[model samples]
Target: MPTGAAQRPSVSSPRKRRGRAGLVLLGLASLLAIRIWVMEPAVVDSDSMEPTLHPGSLVFVFKAAPQLSGIHPGDVVVFQSPQDNSMMIKRVVAVGNQTVEVRDAVLYVDGFAPDEPFVDHESIDGTHFSLRRIPPGEVFVMGDNRERSIDSRDFGTLPLSSLQGLVLGAGR
Candidate 1:
């Protein structure tokens, strides 16, 4: 080698390169598993959850939350739309075996109305729905913007099996 010449860096061995590629593949597989069984990112596509979640908003859905903490009324969840199997986000208003009704645009569950500060009641008209019982293993859901949302009121209660995850939070 010439004394004043710069030395070239040695190339990594083929075995080392293959090992690094395997590690990269393993890392990617782990991430895919986590997204499938732990958490996932979803985008809101409608005004259904306005005042809480807006169109184009990004949200994280915790897929294991329901199994870890159980589903309850007032919980925001992601589920498959019964009509088209498309994804949707909504709040659980009535759980299994509960009776639900809407009178004068007010929601009543099991003969008592729960406080819904998230709902946009100003846009609601004289909506009246007869009482219906939620069957075991099913839940009734509604959007915060009830006036513009097509939810359980239109499609009826959904089976718990249709639920995909719980909304942990939203991002701008």
Candidate 2:
């Protein structure tokens, strides 16, 4: 009967390693595709969205937002700044030919106060200098922490061309 040598199978060790490597490659490829085409993760940078999004927290954004729902007031959004390529994340207060005014420490949308319960108590009117109607195809954004945010009050309304996407959800 055949002994030690004959008992050894003819499988090559290197081929087994290659098969595992191929599986790993396939997994990495799928992850990359999902990141680029499906979703993107972002880290909150400041307290601008306090009571909602906290600094250093991770959040996911719908990359197809601009192409899908566009943008609307009350939606938390993420966009590239027109003044700078840096990213800017804020809440959509008013969009497209709507007037956004902060007066007597109240936020009025299209001439009516919105149900913004997320605003902090210390926030006495928007420090971003009161403003009038936002231009067509433009959006007025502001941070939840109205006390310390420079949004439309500083650069005026944001052009739709400057938006990146809307944040769908956030992680603690």
Candidate 3:
């Protein structure tokens, strides 16, 4: 080498570059798999869940939750709207074969009113729904903000197959 000449910087070999790229691809694939079969993030787009889940709230939806843990009354869940196929979030009020009714703004399951502290009763406007029996494979869901939410009262019961996931928790 000539005196005063600058030395060239070391370059990564092709094998090393390929290895790094392969690792990145593997990591991405793992994330995709988890999202598809395990869990995913969802955004609440309406005030239907009000005190429990507000509009623009970010929540974690565990896709495998239903399989691991049975869904019951008071559980928040995500599903497709039967009317327009849009995504919706609501709390399960009645399970399969359960009779649900709302009289004078009070919710009744199997003729008994369950205490729901999360409900926005002030927003309820004398809503009265006749008794409806949920099918063996369906659930009745409703929004905490009843007056503003279009839920089972409007669309009837939702099949368990339509449920996308269970809302585990909220995020900032």
Candidate 4:
């Protein structure tokens, strides 16, 4: 009868390695599928969403966020910039049929101010701005760092269709 060293089986077999490799590839493929069809992870690229989303912070985006619950004010979203066609992340300040205005460093939605705790206090510099009503099928977005962000204030309201998705949460 085989015993001790003579009976011991090789742990480093090619078959076992191939099985492990196949499992790893399967796991990677599953993750790729989820990212493509379910959620996508993104890195914050600018201070535009400071206080809320810092630069380099990782965030997960819902590819079908609007489908879950239609876009609304205060929802952080990613969209294509009309100015340069680059992707930008900002908070939805006003939706279609709403009025947005800046006066004395204060933001007013409709006719009243909405509590915005995520905005950078020192970044607001709304000295004087006219009231602009968001047209249908569009939204008014603003960066948390209002003063430095070139958003709707610089370009104008964005088409709702341009939005890619909403920032669901931070991390993977």
User: Candidate 4 clashing pairs?
Assistant: 105-126
Q: Which lDDT values do the candidates have, in the order given?
A: 0.90, 0.79, 0.87, 0.84
List TM-scores for all candidates, in order. Answer: 0.85, 0.79, 0.85, 0.79
Q: Candidate 3 has which clashing residue pairs, if any?
A: none
RMSD of 3: 3.6
lDDT of 1 at 44: 94
The sequence of per-residue lDDT tens digits that candidate 4 reaches over residues 95-155 is 9999999888788999898898766556565455699999998999888878768889888
RMSD (CA, angstroms), candidate 4: 3.6
Q: What are the per-residue Cα lDDT tens digits for candidate 1 across 1-172? A: 5778787899999999999999999999999999999999999999999888999999999999878887899889999898898899999999999999999899999999998888867789989889999999999999989998999999999888788899986311
Q: Could you tell me the lDDT of residue 14 within candidate 1?
A: 98
Per-residue accuracy of model 3 over 7-41 as CA lDDT, tens digit each: 88999999999999999999999999999999999
Backbone collision count in every prediction?
0, 0, 0, 1
For candidate 2, the lDDT comes to 0.79
Candidate 2 residue-wise lDDT, 1-172, digit = tens: 6566656667769989899999999999999987886678999888888878889989898877777877878888888766776787899889887888777667888779888888864656433346587888988888887877667777778888777777886311
Worst 10 residues of 1 by lDDT: 163-172
User: After superposing candidate 1, which stretches have Cα over 4 Å from the reference?
Assistant: 1-19, 170-172
